[model samples]
Target: MRQGSNFLWFLRAAVGAAILLGAVLLTACGSVEDVDLTPACPTGVGRGIWDPGSLEGKDAGPEVRKLLESPRFGATPQAVRDLERGIVDQRLIAALRTLTQEHRICVRAFKEGHYFLPGVEDGPRIPEGYGKAGGLPNTHYYGRAADVWWVDGKPVEGNATDQDVMEIGEILAGIPSGRRPDQIIGPPRWARDLGYGNQRGWILAPDQLELHRDHIHIGYVNGEATNETR
Candidate 1:
């Protein structure tokens, strides 16, 4: 009878262990599923939280934290460092990565005063203050935009020639429009060629020859407007 009791106790312990193991496995699987796990941008780099309101250094939520850690945005050493301190949209980072990698070029984070809320007296206004049609600042205020220059084969933040920067813009212009009415703004031809006559909104073409001569601007645009400049 004692032998029989020992066997029963062993069986009970074994069953308990199996149940605990199953619970652990189930918890892990559930965790993987419950997380958004969506590619940060469209390129399968990182997980992006769509909240544009969370600026860098301001919002460190789990979703945004995951995006900041993505390797796709870590093109140049400077870019990787910038990702730590600044907050730009995941799409913008992904697009910039594509441009630099495709052409073997290098670009860094926008100069300190360029992004929305540069935290300086003379910094440029966010797009919301641009005073133009469809200029509600969805892109700049949300940190979904960048002004990148071509530093051919140099480290991020390296100086770029005018021709090299223009070339970078041309390639960036060809990227398809995004879920929002995104644009690549630089030389007129680049914008006109890619943005002509599509259901999507027009990519802006600079009228002045000297506009954006130093860099290319690409990112989201204001909401749809009938009078939006193409």
Candidate 2:
């Protein structure tokens, strides 16, 4: 009788262990199913957040943190497969990762004073009061988009080139042939007057050009350029 009881206990213990293992596997699978992963990225020599898979920086939240740590977003998933195939452009993929992180109407990398082009001059330094779009005192607007050049820990000679910066203007122009939209803030008339429509057309409110002469101020609902949803 004692021998029989020992056999039964052993069977129960084995079954319990199996159940625990099954629970762990199920939990892991569930977690994997709940993350958004990007694909394998080309290793750019530059230090930008081009690799969305490594998005576990101080800026990420729980959802982003979980996604970065999971297999679906990490490897062996459609997003990863797309990246490996070059089905998605690395720059565009990086941009999308940035755009989706917040409900930001516009995403820009702004510097100080002027719109961040490759070069600058020593005029009266723009004070703290200066901002993009209509960023005026006592009357600031949200989603009036703009970008400034920013490079951390690198000494700038005040004569940077397009190659050094991510010229989004050039990227937007190439979108049309690829079956994407012409652009949100299209090429300037200055560019078109020079006649280069062999590429896709650009998109920006013609009337507001004067107001945005200094910055590429993108507004969401000014009855002009309100395409913040994309």
Largest TM-score belongs to which candidate? 1
Pairs clashing in candidate 2? 37-73, 39-80, 109-148, 110-148, 186-202, 186-203, 220-226
Worst 10 residues of 1 by lDDT: 38-47
Best by lDDT: 1
What C-alpha root-mean-square deviation, in Å, does candidate 2 show against the real structure? 15.0
Backbone clash pairs for candidate 1 read 40-46, 40-48
- lDDT (tens digit, per residue) of candidate 2 on 124-162: 232232334232221011212222222221111231232
lDDT of each: 0.46, 0.33
lDDT of 2 at 91: 30
As a TM-score, model 2 comes out at 0.25
Instruction: Give the runs in model 1 whose Cα sits over 4 Å from its true position.
Output: 1-82, 106-111, 115-135, 151-170, 173-181, 189-202, 205-210, 222-230
Q: What is every candidate's alpha-carbon RMSD to the true fold?
A: 12.2, 15.0
